[model samples]
Target chain A: MKIAHHAHKDIVIPNSTRHLVTVRQAVFDVIQESGFPEHEMLRIALAIDEALSNIMEHAFETENLKAELTINLSLDADEEKFEALILDSGKEFDPGEIESPDILTHVASGQKTGLGIFLMRQVMNEVKYTFVSGFRNELRMIKYAHDFKTKGATNAGTQDHYQNH
Target chain B: MPELKITTKIIDHDITLIRLVGFLDAHTFEELDVVINDLFEKNIHKIVADLSALEYISSAGAGVFIGALAAAQENSGNIILAAANENIHEVFDLLGLTQIFTMTDSVETAAKAFECNA
Candidate 1:
Protein backbone atom coordinates (compact mmCIF):
# COMPACT_ATOMS: atom_id res chain seq x y z
CA MET A 1 0.00 0.00 0.00
CA LYS A 2 1.24 3.44 -0.89
CA ILE A 3 0.22 6.56 1.02
CA ALA A 4 1.01 9.94 -0.50
CA HIS A 5 0.46 13.52 0.69
CA HIS A 6 1.66 16.96 -0.30
CA ALA A 7 1.46 20.20 1.70
CA HIS A 8 2.29 23.64 0.37
CA LYS A 9 2.15 26.82 2.39
CA ASP A 10 3.57 30.27 1.77
CA ILE A 11 6.35 31.58 3.97
CA VAL A 12 4.70 33.31 6.90
CA ILE A 13 5.99 34.20 10.33
CA PRO A 14 3.75 31.63 11.98
CA ASN A 15 4.98 28.90 9.66
CA SER A 16 8.55 29.41 10.77
CA THR A 17 8.50 27.60 14.11
CA ARG A 18 4.91 27.61 15.39
CA HIS A 19 3.65 25.69 12.36
CA LEU A 20 6.07 22.84 13.06
CA VAL A 21 3.29 21.06 14.93
CA THR A 22 0.91 21.43 11.99
CA VAL A 23 3.45 20.19 9.50
CA ARG A 24 4.37 17.34 11.80
CA GLN A 25 0.69 16.43 12.33
CA ALA A 26 0.05 16.28 8.62
CA VAL A 27 2.84 13.71 8.32
CA PHE A 28 1.79 11.86 11.46
CA ASP A 29 -1.67 11.52 9.95
CA VAL A 30 -0.08 9.79 7.00
CA ILE A 31 1.79 7.40 9.33
CA GLN A 32 -1.43 6.56 11.14
CA GLU A 33 -3.20 6.11 7.84
CA SER A 34 -0.41 3.79 6.77
CA GLY A 35 -0.97 1.68 9.89
CA PHE A 36 2.23 2.70 11.64
CA PRO A 37 2.57 3.65 15.30
CA GLU A 38 3.11 7.14 16.71
CA HIS A 39 6.80 6.65 17.40
CA GLU A 40 7.58 5.98 13.76
CA MET A 41 5.51 8.97 12.75
CA LEU A 42 7.36 11.31 15.11
CA ARG A 43 10.76 10.32 13.83
CA ILE A 44 9.57 11.19 10.36
CA ALA A 45 8.02 14.42 11.61
CA LEU A 46 11.17 15.59 13.44
CA ALA A 47 13.26 14.87 10.37
CA ILE A 48 10.86 16.89 8.28
CA ASP A 49 11.09 19.74 10.76
CA GLU A 50 14.88 19.75 10.59
CA ALA A 51 14.82 19.77 6.80
CA LEU A 52 12.22 22.53 6.61
CA SER A 53 14.07 24.63 9.17
CA ASN A 54 17.17 24.45 7.01
CA ILE A 55 15.26 25.43 3.88
CA MET A 56 13.51 28.34 5.56
CA GLU A 57 16.76 29.61 6.99
CA HIS A 58 19.07 28.94 4.04
CA ALA A 59 16.65 29.35 1.12
CA PHE A 60 15.19 32.66 2.19
CA GLU A 61 17.30 35.56 3.29
CA THR A 62 16.27 37.09 6.58
CA GLU A 63 15.53 40.51 5.02
CA ASN A 64 13.34 39.58 2.01
CA LEU A 65 12.02 36.31 3.38
CA LYS A 66 8.67 34.82 2.26
CA ALA A 67 9.40 31.63 0.43
CA GLU A 68 7.21 28.57 0.05
CA LEU A 69 8.03 25.19 1.63
CA THR A 70 6.64 22.12 -0.08
CA ILE A 71 6.70 18.74 1.64
CA ASN A 72 5.92 15.45 -0.07
CA LEU A 73 5.17 12.50 2.21
CA SER A 74 4.90 8.94 0.93
CA LEU A 75 4.68 5.65 2.77
CA ASP A 76 4.86 2.10 1.54
CA ALA A 77 2.45 -0.11 3.40
CA ASP A 78 4.01 -3.39 2.37
CA GLU A 79 7.49 -2.24 3.24
CA GLU A 80 6.38 -0.37 6.35
CA LYS A 81 8.44 2.55 5.25
CA PHE A 82 8.20 6.35 5.18
CA GLU A 83 9.78 8.94 2.90
CA ALA A 84 9.63 12.73 2.76
CA LEU A 85 10.94 15.29 0.29
CA ILE A 86 11.41 18.90 1.31
CA LEU A 87 11.59 21.35 -1.61
CA ASP A 88 12.50 24.98 -1.29
CA SER A 89 13.57 27.76 -3.66
CA GLY A 90 16.02 29.16 -1.17
CA LYS A 91 19.79 29.52 -1.27
CA GLU A 92 22.02 26.59 -2.13
CA PHE A 93 23.37 24.47 0.73
CA ASP A 94 24.94 21.04 1.11
CA PRO A 95 24.79 19.61 4.64
CA GLY A 96 27.08 16.67 3.90
CA GLU A 97 30.24 18.70 4.31
CA ILE A 98 29.10 20.08 7.63
CA GLU A 99 30.96 18.18 10.37
CA SER A 100 29.22 17.00 13.51
CA PRO A 101 30.23 18.70 16.70
CA ASP A 102 31.98 16.54 19.27
CA ILE A 103 29.23 16.15 21.86
CA LEU A 104 31.78 15.22 24.50
CA THR A 105 33.53 18.50 24.06
CA HIS A 106 30.32 20.49 23.78
CA VAL A 107 29.01 18.73 26.86
CA ALA A 108 31.87 20.29 28.73
CA SER A 109 31.51 23.79 27.32
CA GLY A 110 29.57 25.20 24.30
CA GLN A 111 27.40 24.13 21.29
CA LYS A 112 27.70 24.02 17.49
CA THR A 113 25.57 24.20 14.25
CA GLY A 114 26.46 21.31 11.93
CA LEU A 115 25.24 18.79 14.52
CA GLY A 116 21.72 18.92 13.06
CA ILE A 117 22.67 17.33 9.75
CA PHE A 118 24.83 14.72 11.45
CA LEU A 119 22.03 13.61 13.73
CA MET A 120 19.69 13.27 10.75
CA ARG A 121 22.19 11.04 9.02
CA GLN A 122 22.33 8.80 12.06
CA VAL A 123 18.57 8.42 12.69
CA MET A 124 17.22 8.27 9.14
CA ASN A 125 18.10 5.35 6.91
CA GLU A 126 18.84 7.58 3.95
CA VAL A 127 19.34 11.32 3.53
CA LYS A 128 20.27 13.05 0.27
CA TYR A 129 20.92 16.69 -0.60
CA THR A 130 20.60 18.11 -4.08
CA PHE A 131 20.31 21.49 -5.77
CA VAL A 132 18.52 22.31 -9.01
CA SER A 133 19.77 25.39 -10.93
CA GLY A 134 21.41 26.71 -7.77
CA PHE A 135 18.03 28.22 -6.87
CA ARG A 136 16.06 25.26 -5.57
CA ASN A 137 17.14 22.91 -2.79
CA GLU A 138 15.82 19.43 -2.24
CA LEU A 139 16.32 17.20 0.79
CA ARG A 140 15.03 13.65 0.48
CA MET A 141 14.89 11.43 3.59
CA ILE A 142 13.64 7.87 3.91
CA LYS A 143 13.30 5.39 6.78
CA TYR A 144 11.94 1.86 7.11
CA ALA A 145 10.28 0.60 10.26
CA HIS A 146 11.55 -2.90 9.68
CA ASP A 147 15.12 -1.69 9.24
CA PHE A 148 15.38 -0.68 12.88
CA LYS A 149 18.72 1.02 12.23
CA THR A 150 17.97 4.30 14.01
CA LYS A 151 15.63 4.62 16.95
CA GLY A 152 14.57 6.25 20.20
CA ALA A 153 12.84 4.49 23.11
CA THR A 154 9.51 6.16 22.27
CA ASN A 155 9.06 5.05 18.68
CA ALA A 156 5.80 4.30 16.91
CA GLY A 157 3.54 1.60 18.40
CA THR A 158 5.17 2.22 21.76
CA GLN A 159 2.83 3.63 24.38
CA ASP A 160 5.27 5.71 26.42
CA HIS A 161 6.52 8.97 24.93
CA TYR A 162 8.73 11.33 26.84
CA GLN A 163 7.06 14.42 25.45
CA ASN A 164 9.14 16.33 27.96
CA HIS A 165 11.70 15.18 30.57
CA MET B 1 16.51 25.73 13.42
CA PRO B 2 17.75 24.71 16.86
CA GLU B 3 17.38 27.62 19.27
CA LEU B 4 20.67 27.80 21.24
CA LYS B 5 19.77 29.93 24.24
CA ILE B 6 22.76 30.71 26.47
CA THR B 7 22.57 31.26 30.22
CA THR B 8 25.51 31.48 32.60
CA LYS B 9 26.33 30.54 36.20
CA ILE B 10 29.34 30.99 38.42
CA ILE B 11 31.06 27.70 39.20
CA ASP B 12 34.16 28.26 41.26
CA HIS B 13 36.56 30.91 39.95
CA ASP B 14 37.37 29.57 36.47
CA ILE B 15 34.39 27.47 35.44
CA THR B 16 31.22 28.93 33.81
CA LEU B 17 27.91 27.14 33.34
CA ILE B 18 25.95 27.44 30.08
CA ARG B 19 22.32 26.40 29.91
CA LEU B 20 21.00 25.36 26.44
CA VAL B 21 17.32 25.18 25.71
CA GLY B 22 14.99 24.47 22.77
CA PHE B 23 16.17 22.94 19.53
CA LEU B 24 19.80 23.67 18.54
CA ASP B 25 19.66 22.57 14.92
CA ALA B 26 21.05 24.11 11.74
CA HIS B 27 19.33 27.45 12.16
CA THR B 28 20.79 28.54 15.48
CA PHE B 29 23.85 26.30 15.66
CA GLU B 30 26.37 28.94 14.70
CA GLU B 31 25.25 31.22 17.47
CA LEU B 32 26.77 28.78 19.94
CA ASP B 33 30.22 29.56 18.58
CA VAL B 34 29.71 33.30 18.83
CA VAL B 35 28.41 33.05 22.35
CA ILE B 36 31.29 30.91 23.51
CA ASN B 37 33.88 33.09 21.84
CA ASP B 38 32.54 36.04 23.74
CA LEU B 39 32.68 34.00 26.90
CA PHE B 40 36.30 33.10 26.23
CA GLU B 41 37.21 36.73 26.76
CA LYS B 42 35.68 36.45 30.22
CA ASN B 43 38.20 33.64 31.04
CA ILE B 44 35.71 30.78 31.25
CA HIS B 45 37.90 27.76 30.59
CA LYS B 46 35.72 25.07 32.15
CA ILE B 47 32.14 24.96 30.85
CA VAL B 48 29.11 22.87 31.74
CA ALA B 49 26.10 22.86 29.38
CA ASP B 50 22.63 21.96 30.66
CA LEU B 51 20.69 20.20 27.86
CA SER B 52 17.66 19.31 29.99
CA ALA B 53 15.36 21.69 28.11
CA LEU B 54 16.98 20.92 24.75
CA GLU B 55 14.62 18.91 22.56
CA TYR B 56 16.58 18.29 19.33
CA ILE B 57 20.06 18.48 17.77
CA SER B 58 21.76 17.53 14.45
CA SER B 59 25.33 16.81 13.26
CA ALA B 60 26.01 20.35 12.18
CA GLY B 61 25.03 21.40 15.65
CA ALA B 62 27.43 18.76 16.88
CA GLY B 63 30.21 20.43 14.90
CA VAL B 64 29.71 23.57 16.95
CA PHE B 65 30.47 21.64 20.09
CA ILE B 66 33.61 20.14 18.60
CA GLY B 67 34.86 23.53 17.49
CA ALA B 68 34.18 25.05 20.88
CA LEU B 69 35.90 22.14 22.55
CA ALA B 70 39.01 22.69 20.47
CA ALA B 71 38.89 26.39 21.19
CA ALA B 72 38.50 25.89 24.89
CA GLN B 73 41.13 23.18 25.03
CA GLU B 74 43.66 25.51 23.45
CA ASN B 75 43.04 27.88 26.32
CA SER B 76 43.40 25.03 28.82
CA GLY B 77 39.61 24.88 29.34
CA ASN B 78 37.11 22.08 28.89
CA ILE B 79 33.41 21.50 27.96
CA ILE B 80 31.13 18.99 29.67
CA LEU B 81 27.54 17.96 28.90
CA ALA B 82 25.03 17.49 31.68
CA ALA B 83 21.74 15.56 31.87
CA ALA B 84 21.25 14.60 28.22
CA ASN B 85 18.25 12.52 27.22
CA GLU B 86 18.52 9.12 25.59
CA ASN B 87 18.14 10.54 22.11
CA ILE B 88 20.96 12.97 22.71
CA HIS B 89 23.11 10.24 24.17
CA GLU B 90 22.46 8.13 21.11
CA VAL B 91 23.93 10.93 19.05
CA PHE B 92 27.04 11.08 21.19
CA ASP B 93 27.40 7.32 21.19
CA LEU B 94 27.16 7.12 17.41
CA LEU B 95 29.88 9.72 17.05
CA GLY B 96 32.05 7.81 19.57
CA LEU B 97 32.29 10.97 21.65
CA THR B 98 31.01 9.10 24.66
CA GLN B 99 34.52 7.82 25.18
CA ILE B 100 36.29 11.08 24.47
CA PHE B 101 34.24 13.56 26.49
CA THR B 102 32.62 13.30 29.90
CA MET B 103 28.85 12.81 30.26
CA THR B 104 26.74 12.76 33.39
CA ASP B 105 23.13 12.15 34.27
CA SER B 106 22.66 15.49 36.01
CA VAL B 107 24.16 18.97 36.00
CA GLU B 108 25.68 18.52 39.42
CA THR B 109 27.37 15.30 38.42
CA ALA B 110 28.51 16.84 35.15
CA ALA B 111 30.15 19.73 36.95
CA LYS B 112 31.87 17.34 39.30
CA ALA B 113 33.09 15.28 36.35
CA PHE B 114 34.75 18.30 34.77
CA GLU B 115 36.14 19.60 38.04
CA CYS B 116 37.55 16.19 38.83
CA ASN B 117 38.56 14.88 35.39
CA ALA B 118 38.91 17.66 32.77
Candidate 2:
Protein backbone atom coordinates (compact mmCIF):
# COMPACT_ATOMS: atom_id res chain seq x y z
CA MET A 1 0.00 0.00 0.00
CA LYS A 2 1.16 3.51 -0.81
CA ILE A 3 0.44 6.65 1.21
CA ALA A 4 -0.45 9.94 -0.43
CA HIS A 5 1.30 13.09 0.70
CA HIS A 6 -0.15 16.54 1.41
CA ALA A 7 -0.38 18.98 -1.50
CA HIS A 8 1.02 22.49 -1.33
CA LYS A 9 0.96 25.44 -3.72
CA ASP A 10 2.44 28.92 -3.54
CA ILE A 11 1.45 31.94 -5.60
CA VAL A 12 2.57 35.56 -5.70
CA ILE A 13 0.69 38.26 -7.49
CA PRO A 14 0.64 42.04 -7.55
CA ASN A 15 -1.64 43.53 -4.93
CA SER A 16 -4.46 44.24 -7.33
CA THR A 17 -8.06 43.10 -7.70
CA ARG A 18 -7.38 42.20 -11.32
CA HIS A 19 -5.91 38.89 -10.23
CA LEU A 20 -8.68 37.92 -7.80
CA VAL A 21 -10.43 35.72 -10.31
CA THR A 22 -7.30 33.77 -11.08
CA VAL A 23 -6.53 33.37 -7.41
CA ARG A 24 -10.03 32.15 -6.71
CA GLN A 25 -9.89 29.56 -9.45
CA ALA A 26 -6.59 28.32 -8.20
CA VAL A 27 -7.94 28.08 -4.65
CA PHE A 28 -10.95 26.15 -5.83
CA ASP A 29 -8.78 23.70 -7.72
CA VAL A 30 -6.73 22.99 -4.63
CA ILE A 31 -9.82 22.50 -2.47
CA GLN A 32 -11.39 20.18 -4.97
CA GLU A 33 -8.18 18.14 -5.21
CA SER A 34 -8.17 17.85 -1.44
CA GLY A 35 -11.53 16.09 -1.53
CA PHE A 36 -13.55 18.81 0.19
CA PRO A 37 -17.31 18.61 -0.26
CA GLU A 38 -18.66 20.79 -3.06
CA HIS A 39 -20.55 23.10 -0.69
CA GLU A 40 -17.53 23.63 1.55
CA MET A 41 -15.30 24.35 -1.46
CA LEU A 42 -17.29 27.41 -2.44
CA ARG A 43 -17.45 28.65 1.13
CA ILE A 44 -13.69 28.34 1.46
CA ALA A 45 -13.17 30.20 -1.80
CA LEU A 46 -15.42 33.03 -0.61
CA ALA A 47 -13.43 33.37 2.59
CA ILE A 48 -10.21 33.79 0.62
CA ASP A 49 -11.81 36.31 -1.73
CA GLU A 50 -13.01 38.41 1.19
CA ALA A 51 -9.59 38.37 2.82
CA LEU A 52 -7.78 39.43 -0.36
CA SER A 53 -10.37 42.11 -1.08
CA ASN A 54 -9.83 43.60 2.34
CA ILE A 55 -6.08 43.65 1.90
CA MET A 56 -6.36 45.41 -1.44
CA GLU A 57 -9.03 47.93 -0.39
CA HIS A 58 -7.61 48.79 3.03
CA ALA A 59 -3.95 47.78 3.21
CA PHE A 60 -2.85 49.03 -0.18
CA GLU A 61 -5.18 51.99 -0.57
CA THR A 62 -2.83 54.38 -2.33
CA GLU A 63 -1.81 53.79 -5.91
CA ASN A 64 1.82 54.24 -4.92
CA LEU A 65 1.48 51.58 -2.24
CA LYS A 66 -0.11 49.15 -4.66
CA ALA A 67 2.42 49.80 -7.38
CA GLU A 68 5.23 48.17 -5.46
CA LEU A 69 3.38 45.70 -3.26
CA THR A 70 2.65 42.04 -3.91
CA ILE A 71 0.49 39.51 -2.14
CA ASN A 72 2.04 36.10 -1.38
CA LEU A 73 -0.41 33.24 -1.05
CA SER A 74 0.17 29.63 -0.02
CA LEU A 75 -2.29 26.77 -0.01
CA ASP A 76 -1.68 23.54 1.90
CA ALA A 77 -4.19 20.75 2.11
CA ASP A 78 -4.35 17.18 3.31
CA GLU A 79 -7.02 14.63 4.01
CA GLU A 80 -7.64 16.27 7.37
CA LYS A 81 -7.53 20.02 6.77
CA PHE A 82 -7.18 22.85 4.25
CA GLU A 83 -5.05 25.86 5.16
CA ALA A 84 -4.28 29.17 3.46
CA LEU A 85 -1.53 31.59 4.37
CA ILE A 86 -1.70 35.07 2.86
CA LEU A 87 1.24 37.43 3.22
CA ASP A 88 1.31 41.08 2.26
CA SER A 89 3.63 43.99 2.82
CA GLY A 90 0.87 46.52 3.34
CA LYS A 91 -0.65 48.24 6.34
CA GLU A 92 -1.64 46.28 9.43
CA PHE A 93 -5.29 45.36 9.92
CA ASP A 94 -6.89 43.44 12.77
CA PRO A 95 -10.25 42.01 11.79
CA GLY A 96 -10.97 40.95 15.37
CA GLU A 97 -11.53 44.50 16.62
CA ILE A 98 -14.24 45.23 14.13
CA GLU A 99 -17.55 44.42 15.75
CA SER A 100 -19.89 42.06 13.94
CA PRO A 101 -22.91 43.96 12.68
CA ASP A 102 -26.47 43.02 13.46
CA ILE A 103 -27.59 42.09 9.94
CA LEU A 104 -31.01 43.74 10.24
CA THR A 105 -29.64 47.00 11.64
CA HIS A 106 -26.79 46.98 9.16
CA VAL A 107 -29.04 46.83 6.10
CA ALA A 108 -31.67 49.14 7.54
CA SER A 109 -28.94 51.76 8.10
CA GLY A 110 -28.11 51.73 4.35
CA GLN A 111 -24.64 50.32 4.81
CA LYS A 112 -23.19 48.35 1.92
CA THR A 113 -19.65 47.47 2.88
CA GLY A 114 -18.16 45.97 6.09
CA LEU A 115 -19.56 42.49 5.60
CA GLY A 116 -16.42 40.81 4.17
CA ILE A 117 -14.75 40.20 7.50
CA PHE A 118 -17.95 38.83 8.96
CA LEU A 119 -18.31 36.38 6.09
CA MET A 120 -14.70 35.25 6.43
CA ARG A 121 -15.20 34.57 10.11
CA GLN A 122 -18.39 32.67 9.50
CA VAL A 123 -16.96 30.15 7.00
CA MET A 124 -13.47 29.41 8.24
CA ASN A 125 -12.73 27.36 11.33
CA GLU A 126 -9.63 29.40 12.21
CA VAL A 127 -8.77 33.00 11.28
CA LYS A 128 -5.44 34.15 12.71
CA TYR A 129 -3.72 37.47 12.06
CA THR A 130 -0.18 38.55 12.81
CA PHE A 131 1.82 41.68 12.01
CA VAL A 132 5.50 42.53 12.27
CA SER A 133 6.09 46.26 12.54
CA GLY A 134 7.37 47.74 9.27
CA PHE A 135 7.79 44.28 7.80
CA ARG A 136 4.75 42.20 6.84
CA ASN A 137 1.23 41.12 7.74
CA GLU A 138 0.24 37.48 7.84
CA LEU A 139 -3.23 35.99 7.88
CA ARG A 140 -3.69 32.25 8.29
CA MET A 141 -7.08 30.69 7.73
CA ILE A 142 -7.92 27.02 8.17
CA LYS A 143 -10.96 24.79 7.78
CA TYR A 144 -11.07 21.25 9.07
CA ALA A 145 -13.11 18.65 7.18
CA HIS A 146 -14.59 17.40 10.42
CA ASP A 147 -15.73 20.88 11.41
CA PHE A 148 -17.90 21.11 8.32
CA LYS A 149 -19.67 17.88 9.12
CA THR A 150 -20.47 19.13 12.65
CA LYS A 151 -21.75 22.57 11.79
CA GLY A 152 -22.12 25.28 14.46
CA ALA A 153 -19.50 23.67 16.66
CA THR A 154 -18.33 26.14 19.31
CA ASN A 155 -15.29 28.36 18.76
CA ALA A 156 -13.70 26.64 21.72
CA GLY A 157 -12.35 24.04 19.30
CA THR A 158 -10.61 26.64 17.13
CA GLN A 159 -8.00 29.30 17.74
CA ASP A 160 -8.37 32.98 16.85
CA HIS A 161 -4.73 33.91 17.24
CA TYR A 162 -3.68 37.53 16.77
CA GLN A 163 -0.10 38.54 17.42
CA ASN A 164 2.07 41.64 16.95
CA HIS A 165 5.78 41.21 16.85
CA MET B 1 -9.28 39.46 -15.91
CA PRO B 2 -12.41 39.52 -13.78
CA GLU B 3 -15.54 39.63 -15.91
CA LEU B 4 -19.25 40.40 -15.26
CA LYS B 5 -21.81 40.84 -17.99
CA ILE B 6 -25.04 42.67 -17.11
CA THR B 7 -28.05 43.05 -19.37
CA THR B 8 -31.36 44.74 -18.62
CA LYS B 9 -34.92 44.13 -19.86
CA ILE B 10 -38.04 46.21 -19.21
CA ILE B 11 -40.86 44.12 -17.82
CA ASP B 12 -44.40 45.52 -18.00
CA HIS B 13 -43.15 49.15 -18.00
CA ASP B 14 -42.17 49.16 -14.33
CA ILE B 15 -39.92 46.25 -13.43
CA THR B 16 -36.50 45.75 -15.02
CA LEU B 17 -34.90 42.31 -15.30
CA ILE B 18 -31.13 42.43 -15.07
CA ARG B 19 -29.36 39.26 -16.07
CA LEU B 20 -25.94 38.66 -14.51
CA VAL B 21 -23.37 36.36 -16.08
CA GLY B 22 -19.83 35.59 -14.92
CA PHE B 23 -18.12 36.28 -11.63
CA LEU B 24 -19.17 39.14 -9.34
CA ASP B 25 -16.26 39.93 -7.05
CA ALA B 26 -14.41 42.93 -5.68
CA HIS B 27 -12.92 43.60 -9.07
CA THR B 28 -16.28 43.69 -10.87
CA PHE B 29 -18.75 44.83 -8.22
CA GLU B 30 -18.54 48.48 -9.25
CA GLU B 31 -19.95 47.64 -12.67
CA LEU B 32 -23.11 46.37 -10.99
CA ASP B 33 -23.24 49.37 -8.70
CA VAL B 34 -23.11 51.66 -11.71
CA VAL B 35 -25.89 49.77 -13.52
CA ILE B 36 -28.23 49.78 -10.54
CA ASN B 37 -27.54 53.45 -9.86
CA ASP B 38 -28.31 54.20 -13.48
CA LEU B 39 -31.68 52.48 -13.14
CA PHE B 40 -32.46 54.51 -10.02
CA GLU B 41 -31.66 57.70 -11.87
CA LYS B 42 -34.27 56.77 -14.46
CA ASN B 43 -36.89 56.21 -11.67
CA ILE B 44 -36.81 52.49 -12.38
CA HIS B 45 -36.62 51.05 -8.90
CA LYS B 46 -38.52 47.82 -9.29
CA ILE B 47 -35.80 45.41 -10.31
CA VAL B 48 -35.51 41.66 -10.69
CA ALA B 49 -31.97 40.36 -10.96
CA ASP B 50 -31.94 37.08 -12.87
CA LEU B 51 -29.01 35.25 -11.32
CA SER B 52 -29.40 31.88 -13.02
CA ALA B 53 -26.39 32.54 -15.21
CA LEU B 54 -24.33 34.11 -12.46
CA GLU B 55 -21.25 31.99 -11.76
CA TYR B 56 -20.09 33.46 -8.46
CA ILE B 57 -20.58 36.27 -5.91
CA SER B 58 -18.60 37.69 -3.01
CA SER B 59 -19.48 40.16 -0.27
CA ALA B 60 -18.57 43.00 -2.60
CA GLY B 61 -21.10 41.77 -5.11
CA ALA B 62 -23.77 41.29 -2.45
CA GLY B 63 -23.05 44.79 -1.14
CA VAL B 64 -24.33 46.29 -4.38
CA PHE B 65 -27.81 44.92 -3.64
CA ILE B 66 -27.62 45.94 0.02
CA GLY B 67 -26.81 49.54 -0.83
CA ALA B 68 -29.69 49.75 -3.27
CA LEU B 69 -32.40 47.96 -1.27
CA ALA B 70 -33.30 50.89 0.95
CA ALA B 71 -33.53 53.32 -1.95
CA ALA B 72 -35.78 51.00 -3.89
CA GLN B 73 -38.09 50.41 -0.91
CA GLU B 74 -38.38 54.13 -0.11
CA ASN B 75 -39.52 54.73 -3.68
CA SER B 76 -42.28 52.10 -3.41
CA GLY B 77 -40.24 49.62 -5.39
CA ASN B 78 -38.16 46.55 -4.59
CA ILE B 79 -35.32 44.40 -5.89
CA ILE B 80 -36.06 40.70 -6.04
CA LEU B 81 -33.40 38.12 -6.76
CA ALA B 82 -34.39 35.08 -8.80
CA ALA B 83 -32.82 31.80 -9.94
CA ALA B 84 -29.71 31.93 -7.83
CA ASN B 85 -27.79 28.66 -7.96
CA GLU B 86 -27.12 26.75 -4.76
CA ASN B 87 -23.63 28.19 -4.34
CA ILE B 88 -24.87 31.74 -4.74
CA HIS B 89 -27.69 31.10 -2.32
CA GLU B 90 -25.15 29.91 0.23
CA VAL B 91 -23.36 33.25 0.06
CA PHE B 92 -26.62 35.07 0.79
CA ASP B 93 -27.36 32.67 3.60
CA LEU B 94 -23.90 33.19 5.15
CA LEU B 95 -24.37 36.95 5.11
CA GLY B 96 -27.82 36.71 6.70
CA LEU B 97 -29.17 38.35 3.55
CA THR B 98 -31.60 35.52 2.73
CA GLN B 99 -33.81 37.05 5.43
CA ILE B 100 -33.58 40.61 4.17
CA PHE B 101 -33.87 40.12 0.41
CA THR B 102 -36.73 38.56 -1.49
CA MET B 103 -35.65 35.57 -3.58
CA THR B 104 -37.59 33.39 -6.00
CA ASP B 105 -37.22 30.42 -8.30
CA SER B 106 -37.25 32.27 -11.61
CA VAL B 107 -37.45 35.67 -13.25
CA GLU B 108 -41.20 35.27 -13.78
CA THR B 109 -41.73 34.57 -10.09
CA ALA B 110 -39.59 37.54 -9.17
CA ALA B 111 -41.64 39.85 -11.38
CA LYS B 112 -44.78 38.48 -9.76
CA ALA B 113 -43.35 39.33 -6.36
CA PHE B 114 -43.23 42.96 -7.40
CA GLU B 115 -46.88 42.70 -8.55
CA CYS B 116 -47.94 41.23 -5.22
CA ASN B 117 -46.18 43.99 -3.32
CA ALA B 118 -47.99 46.51 -5.47
- Which has the greatest TM-score? 2
Write down the C-alpha DockQ for each prediction: 0.24, 0.89
lDDT of 2 by residue, B1-118 (tens): 3399999999868999999999999999999999999999999999999999999999999999999999999999998999999999989998999999999999999988888878
Lowest-scoring 10 consecutive residues by lDDT in candidate 1 chain A? A156-165
Candidate 1 CAPRI category:
acceptable
Can you write out model 1's per-residue Cα lDDT over B1-118, one digit (the tens) per residue? 4345777887767777788887665556667767777788787878888878777665555667776787778788778888888777766675667786677788888777766754
CA lDDT of each prediction against the hidden true structure: 0.62, 0.88
For candidate 2, write residues A45-81 as lDDT tens digits.
Answer: 8999999999999997677768578899999887678
DockQ of 1: 0.24
- RMSD vs true structure, all candidates: 8.8, 2.5
Per-residue CA lDDT of model 1 for A69-128, tens digit only, reads 443333333235666666666667777656665555554554544344554665567676
